[model samples]
Target: MSKVVLITGASSGIGKSIAHYLIEKGYIVYGTSRNPREKVVNGINFVALDVTKTETIQQAVKEIAEKEGKIDFLINNAGMGITGPIEETPDDEIKRIFDTNYFGVIKVIKAVLPIMRKNNGGFIINITSIAGYMGLPFRGIYSATKGALELTTEAFRMELKDFNIKMTNIAPGDFATNIAAGRYHSPIIKNSPYEKKYKSTLDLMDKHVDKGKDPLIMAEKVYAVMQEKNPTIHYKVGEFIQKFSIALKHILPDKVYEKMLMKHYKL
Candidate 1:
């Protein structure tokens, strides 16, 4: 029997790539996008559902359950990127980021847990970023949301281990995705009294994000995780250099890592 998988934010980038690969792997994929009018990608089915809407969540679940009978995997991949100095970033932008990145995943997980538990087990892959591991200058807000997701993923993995729920977080280095397009956000300095405190650092981050890895590789990581019987709590993907940097960051003193980030980013 083929495993049934549903991926949110499935219209493009990593989610879309994973959908293509999984269908090739024989999983029955039901890909969701905020809009229903996506061009048909051979091998996967697309559905309309916005992660931000609870009714949309219920509707997708009801429809999928009717057709597939059970869902074996749920990829909470619907998220956006917002890069700007915390001080100058708009209050509204901060809320939008969290709503999509953090709460959106939570809503989907809550809806799927019961169905997964009934079947004895299922996998939950949360697409996080390396920023989840370290704080980059202007990426502070984005990092914070992913950091929160990292901890949440861990808790789910441990708490649901006995229930056979497998939760995993995939943290990729800067990827060549349109997430940068979504980076049009106000700097935290907008409302801050200390706007001058971090202007240069914020600008530094915006520039570095331009130099990210190809997003196609990120899709491969998602497909590989699907083949694992028991994936790790956190999997790092991307170029060898970024992987090395993460390893170095893990082993070094906080100040050393901070200095490297500052210098490399020209913060």
Candidate 2:
């Protein structure tokens, strides 16, 4: 029988691509989006959802579980990016980021756990980022969310192993997606003590996103991991930089790496 997959943040970028890829492989994909632009792209099904909304998360799970009988895979692919220095980032904005990127997935995972545990097995693909493995200068808060995800992934992998539930993290290094979709909404950091530092960082972040790898490629890797019988806890998807950055994370000293990050961001 084909696996039943539910993906959050399915409106665009990597989430949208994963939905398409999985559906093509004959998996029943329930794609979630808050303001979904276009629904029903060939092999996919769309469910309107806001990841930050408890009511939406609960409702989406019920709809899928009732219809599909069980959920074989859950991709917590919905996330947002927040840049600028911590001092410049307002408390409200930081809370907002954590609500969407961190707590949002937590809600989805909690809602889906019983279904997967009842079935005794399934896979969870959490779409983290290169920022997950190593910190970036301007993306202070965005990196925090990814780091939280990476740690949570490890905890889930260990905690859920006996139940046959797999938690795999997809850490993509600069995949081309709508990661910067609503950057203009980012609040001004004028009150921030580190305004200058954050401005430079935001500038670099905006400049580079257009040149990243296609998100469809990242989606394909996500597909491969979902199909694995015994998947590793983490896969660094896209480009050699993933492998290199992870390696540097191990081989290089802390200060050395920080220096490199500064140089790379031209900070």
Local distance difference test scores for all models: 0.82, 0.82
Q: What lDDT tens digits, residue by residue, belong to model 2 across residues 1-267?
A: 878999887777888888888877888999998866666766678888888899988998998899888999999988888876665567888888889889998999999999999999888889888787777776768888999998998987899978999888888877677777764235555756666766676666766677888888987898878778988877887668656878897989999988887887777
lDDT of 2: 0.82
Q: Candidate 1: list runs displaced more than 4 Å.
A: 38-41, 187-211
Q: Give TM-scores for every candidate, taking all chains together and pairing residue i with residue i.
A: 0.89, 0.92
Report the error of model 2 at residue 76, Å. 0.7
Candidate 1 lDDT trough over 10 residues, lowest sum: 188-197
Instruction: Please tell me which predicted candidate would have the highest TM-score against the true structure.
Output: 2
> Model 2 misses residue 153 by how many Å?
1.2
lDDT of 2 at 145: 92
